[model samples]
Target chain A: MKIIVCVKQTLDTNASIEIKDGAIHAPGSARIMNPYDEFAVEEAVRIKENQPDTDITLITLGGENSRDILKTGLAMGADRAVHIIDSDLDDFDGLAIARKLYEVIKDREFDLVLCGRQAVDQDRAQVGPALSVLLDIPAITVVTKIDFSEDYSRVVATRQIEGGAERIESPLPLLATCQKGLNTPRLPSLKGIMAARKKEVVEITDLPNTAGSVENDAKLRILELSLPPQRKSAIMLEGQPLDMAKELAQALREKEKVL
Target chain B: MTDKSSIFVWIECQGEQIKPVSLEALHCGLQLSESSGQKVCAVLFCGSKVPDLSPLSDFAPHSLKVFSHGRWQDHNSQAVSSTFFKMIQEQSPRLILLPASNHGKELGALLSGLAQAPLASDCIEVECLGENDFKVKRPIYSGKAYASLALEGAGLHIITLRPNVFRGESGSATVLPEADINTTEPESLSLIVREVIKEAGKIDVTEARVVVSGGLGMQGPENFGLLEDLASVLGGTVGASRPVVDNGWRDYSNQVGQTGRSVSPDLYIACGISGAVQHIAGMSGSKCIVAINKDPNAAIFSVAQYGIVGDALEIVPLLTAEFKKILNG
Candidate 1:
């Protein structure tokens, strides 16, 4: 079995992201492989653990810094890493990005393709399913658990539903999106990190035409970004605290329709 | 007035009733259509008898088209996508819009492939940049940030707009030409939905604006009643963290996180919840977040505008009573 996981590099959640001069800036914080993508990498590695002959490869497209993300994947036990570096690639939308990634794996034969449900940065949640479309494969998003048949020809997976869970079964040559519950992502061991330095981190610069006819780049650029408005604590109130709270509550219910 | 350049709104239906989001989509479609001087039409797909199209008459458009396939009684993405693709190509609508729900996401992505167009999924806003050009805004960085996008190249733009960001209006019902567009269904080979596991809930979180979510600090299932009370007071919904769901304090459907349902409520109140990254991914887009946790350093507080370090059980009742008074007054 062969698996390809799409990983993206993004700013850590703790970083104070701000837009200055129309560019989002992440100061000082080190970039990490998207946490969601970690689930995808873990699932792919787990598949190989079960099937000794399995090979897991990490594929990503970004600038040179993306190599760090690819290295992280390599440290997590992926067989190899492929990075399509293009400084001009930042403007591509979800469908275009999906097409480029799909083109990379279209000719090669792979049993499964795994991706995080959505990158924490983009939040589009389109690439995985869109890639499934371009590759002409079946895909289930937000998969919690996936099990293969004894023959490894079919899979039984659990999908997250609105309030509960739904079980789905799909055959091989499928795209499964990973959410958080599938498996615990393992930390890279000392030996693994050392070995990642020697792993092949091939960079492809030639970009394939995304087959899109409209050349609409980002048109709605942010003029300025600012923090949200501050909300003040109006009154803590006195006497029993409960009575004042109730009075304030009554005033809110009566005056404000939000309740 | 019928225009050569038209905007098509994909109306989703369950049996004979139209989904609420579809109406919301129509409202957006109307704005785009009117602004671009293009005729706006509602395209509805149904398995059997065409649903009540008249209920949607209040959302008047240039026209209405109903597509039917008897076999579509079952939920099949390929069948629906293909049907929509063929109809869209035949009509040559300049732009196509759908709701950014599960079905819409699947259908929009698939049709984008079939039609060879760029798709901006889960967008909250769309603006006409120029003649037939659009700039779409979508949330990025989970709900922590947003990005504005513009699709260039294809004349027929395909997109799935997020709900709640746009409001639905009761446009004066206008009648226009109706067209029936249906195409052949694709054969399914490998995947089949054996059975549907349905979750029980009065309101879906995706459709609710007010949500009361609990985290691990709630202790156990018995304490969830406090959340329910607040939710009832607000006429809102209830959600839980993965831990709470795992503890059986709330149903899995009520779970909000990366692995759970993503929600964009107007007011999200987190009680005794330590905001984990995964949990924040689901509700970070909420308009306002109120965090009630004993630990002031909880990650949830970073994103919460209002934070109260107190017992959830103590705060919830007071909050609920306060809300009830506000609402009643």
Candidate 2:
């Protein structure tokens, strides 16, 4: 089975972003492989582990910062990586990014494609579904559990809805956005990291639409950025814990109107 | 088919009832209609029987488009989008508004891909710029910052409004026309839903008006009873930070943060959780936040409107008791 796992390097969820002078700022913060994407990569590797003949190719679209995530995918046991180097990708919306990926993977052969349900940074769960539409394939989104038939021609996937879980069956050449509760991702061991350095990492930058010094091809344009109003410090009622609790209740009822 | 001046609101129904988020999105569409003279249209893909749409009468959408097929009886967004895309191509409505629910977001993406439309997801504010242009304000990089996006040009635009925000009230009841869409499920509808396991009666964290969340400071799963008690009295649901969820102390559903569900409750009470930026990103959009922790410098305090320094095990119970007495009266 040939599988494709889409990965994205996202703003570390732990990093603080600031808006200074109408621009986003996150000084000295880290960028990590989107945490949800790890589950996708891990699931791919586990399938490879169970079926040694299975080959996993990790594909990512981003600027230079994204290559690091592809390397991480390699350390997580993907066989090879494809890095579509485009600086303008960060400015592109989900559909545009999916179009870029489609440009690369449209002709490739794969039985399954997996990715995170949504990148936490942007919090838009659009790419996987859009990619499925662009690729003209079936997509079972927010899949919590997955099982493949012995022949690898069919799949049974579980996804969570508002009040229930639904098990769906689909054929091969399917796309799924993996959700949490799937499996715990393994940390990269020392040997795997050393071996990953020798693994293949291909870089491609010749896409005509996304070439250098080009305008953002996104349909939506960002006009301005501002921070949500800052919250003032709470009035610390410094008597007894019981009294403070009473005061808090009074505040909720009278001042906050929450009660 | 809806006209070019129609603002289509995709309404999601489960069996017979409309999701609250979908109704909220309709209210948003109605509000947009008021200013731009755009007609409000509701779209639903349902089973054999449609839900009680009289509730939608209060919102007074101009038209309700119903598309039904046996395949839509189950949860299949691809089939649903496949049908909706045809309408998009025919009508080319001015705008499409959806609730930022998991299903709504995915459907928005698929339709946008099919039509090459611009989509602003999780938007808190969407305004008409006149002449088929729109301006939308949504949080980006999580809730750390907000981006105002301008959807210009003559092409159709889509906005998935965030729930619990965009306060719009229902208007007088009006005659709602039912547009019949006679369409069969495409042969591409290959996925089949075999079973559905319901987790009954528990309010999802995203849908909760109030959220009482715990973190590492709770010590163990045993201490979660304190939070559960507090949540029960507050009429809220329980949420947890990553550390507790990672520790196997809580189910992943209760987890809130990056990688977990993003929520924007009216009130969020953080107990014992140190505010990691990841955790804060999921919940900072909440209207009011109260943080209780032993450490005065816990990061969660920064995003909170109120802060109290004390042992969560003790403070949580006291607050629950206080709320019970105050609210009961």
Question: If scored against the real structure, what TM-score would every candidate get?
Answer: 0.86, 0.94
Error of 2 at B194 (Å): 2.0
Task: Give per-residue CA lDDT, model 1, range B87-164, as digits (tens).
Answer: 665667778899887667767777776666667778778877677678787665545456667665436777788766
Q: DockQ for all models, in order?
A: 0.32, 0.54
Give the least accurate 10-residue stretch of model 1 chain B, judged by summed lDDT.
B180-189
Best model number under TM-score: 2
lDDT of 2 at A54: 92
Worst 10 residues of 2 chain B by lDDT: B179-188
Give a tens-digit lDDT track for model 1, residues A1-259.
9999999887875565666766677779778888779999999888888898998889998898889889889999998988988777754467668878987888877999999877766666778877887788988777888988999999988876443455778988999888777888999889889999999877889967655443332222332333323344323234443664565455434553335
RMSD of each: 3.8, 2.9
Report the Cα lDDT for candidate 2.
0.83
Best by DockQ: 2
Q: Against the true structure, whose lDDT is highest?
A: 2
| lDDT (Cα, tens digit) per residue for candidate 2, span B19-38 | 78888888888888888888
Residue-level lDDT for A201 in candidate 2: 89
What lDDT score is found at residue B194 in candidate 1? Answer: 48
